[model samples]
Target: MKEIVIGENQAGQRFDKYLSKYLNEAPKSFLYKMLRKKNITLNGKKATGSEKLKEQDIVRLFLSEETIDKFSQVKVERSHGKLSILYEDKHIAAVNKPSGMLSQKASGSDVSLVEYLTGYLLESGQMKEEDFRCFHPGICNRLDRNTSGIVIAGKTLAGLQEMNEAFKLRSLKKEYLALVEGVVSSGAYLKGYLHKDEKCNKVVVEKEPFEGSVPIETEYRPLAGNQRVTLLNIHLVTGRSHQIRSHLASIGHPVIGDGKYGSKKSNQLFCDSYGVKSQLLHAYRLTMPELKGELNYLSHKVLTAPIPSDMKRVLEGEHIEESIHE
Candidate 1:
């Protein structure tokens, strides 16, 4: 017999959901059968698998030791890559993800920011291997593999739920900085409809709406620029895949080094001159919204990451000063 005591991370989820995590290898039908047979009981009573779990709730599994071991054998492989931490608190952490690092793993073998985060927590003793069975701490916002900057990570269940809600409501402010081809003397608020092509892994921005298109909002202002290129501060009003790159390209100002949505001539020039490779897009800043709970301490707070070396080198090479304050 195995007794599971619900913790903060394990609470507030449905009984069946918690069971699925606990006995991860067990089939859903088998779990429901156990519940019906009282082989799995909640607080010493037969459950319907729909009960809401609470902290201190007791779950009894009356299965053989071998059966329990077979089902609860999932493991987390911790990555050793170091994280550039921007801000951290008890409930949340914001990391400065370097360019070329994924916010999350793309395949089973790939390690990304999430693995780094798990490793950090385990090494620091903030979490243990056992905690992963119930709740896996992870990033709330995702950055493209080539984009660098502030990615928020939730350290606790409450933190995850609240931050996810904030982002869904667009209450949190996200900003980026990009160096684009040609000079942009003025800023503009761009509104368009974006349609993504899954096969090509690209997107198109149209001034008018079309089928399967979503409305996107992007705003940009020239922070510093020369005749050849402009460094713009982008406000991502409505976060969408490739919205900034495609929207700016539609306006004839594709981001430098963005081969997919940018000018080839400009990309090659920067690649040869400054050894540039990926797009020069950086998620520069994030601002938290007012909150009412554990994350209230982060209310109205602003977090920023400095421009990376490669991007900064390009700015210096072009004589464009980076005036954005960190």
Candidate 2:
């Protein structure tokens, strides 16, 4: 028999969901069997799988301890890849994930940024895959597979819950720098409806209403501009699939090297001349509330990754002038 005490982070989640974390190796049949046998109790009363847990709830399990031991003994492998750890503490860690790395494991591949971090934790004696119930390490927000930028991961379940809430409430702010073809007007607000086409693996931007289309708003400021290209500071008011790229393309200013929504001829010219493979978009800044209130005002962190060589070459070649706003 084992007693599991719920914390503030685990509260409000379904009983079955919570149990699934602890009983990692237990099959679905075994879980339902235990539930049917009334082997799981909450605060000394029989609990149902649908029951919602509350903070400080005492959950008692009559299942054999050997089951949990077997699950814990299973070792998950470490993924071989490069991950730059930006910031880390007992509760969470921030990483600068490079382009081409999947944020999490895909349908078949076990190697991903998250798996790599998990392996790092295990090697550091901080956690194991089975112990994820108590110390739930996970990525809070997602970035596109081809987009590179800062990624925040929670080291504990509480941290995950808090960060999730932060993102949900829009308390977290993310800023990006993009290099696009043609000169974009300063202080431009692009609003449109974005619809995803799974068949083509692309997103379509429509100025008018379309079936099953979601509204997307992107605010951009032209930081610098020249005859050929411009540097844009982008703010996402409404996050949608390929919102920035699609909207910019709709306005005839697709991001450089964005083959899906850009000028292929321009991309080819730039790639052939400068040798940059991916689009020129970088998440440069992130601001969020910290766990401690002392650093509340200073919670904003700016991350500046070097511009891809291809984009740099183009920008340097052009004689663009930076504009200062009054």
TM-score of each: 0.93, 0.78
| lDDT score, candidate 2 | 0.74
lDDT of 2 by residue, 118-148 (tens): 8788778877455655444789877777677
- Ten consecutive residues with minimal summed lDDT in candidate 2? 289-298
Residue-level lDDT tens digits of model 1 in 189-209? 999999999999899899999
- Return the top candidate by lDDT: 1
